[model samples]
Target: MALMITDECINCDVCEPECPNGAISQGDETYVIDPALCTECVGHYETSQCVEVCPVDCIVKDPSHDESEDDLRAKFERIAGN
Candidate 1:
């Protein structure tokens, strides 16, 4: 599943660079994660980098974009053309 930034996000900008997929970006107020490009760091790391770096713990699973491990891997490969 892709990770999401909740309203609790302080817009610290700490988690933006941590995302390997480059899915996290600044929104109007708080930062946001792009579900289409997000892979939850599946092929890049053991866990979601955004979640690992978020100070406010605002990063959480995006229920609307729920995906399985296999699906995440496929998405990764598709984007990366691997």
Candidate 2:
């Protein structure tokens, strides 16, 4: 599944640069993760780099954009142009 930055985000600015897909960005209030670009780092790393670096632990799986591992892998391929 794609990940989401909740309102709990502390705006620590740590997660933005960690996203391999460049999905995370500064929103009006908090960081936002674009579901269209988010692959949860499936093809780039073993774990979600943004989540690993998040100081507030506000990033979580987006239930609204739920996807399987295969789906995430597919997204990664599309993003990577593989």
Error of 1 at 4 (Å): 0.7
Q: What is the lDDT of residue 56 in candidate 1?
A: 83
lDDT of 1: 0.90
lDDT of 1 at 63: 92
Report the Cα RMSD per candidate.
Answer: 0.7, 0.6
* Per-model tally of clashing residue pairs: 0, 0
Off by over 4 Å in 2: none
Query: In terms of TM-score, how similar is model 2 to the real structure?
Result: 0.97
Report lDDT (Cα) of residue 50, candidate 1. 84
Error of 1 at 62 (Å): 0.7
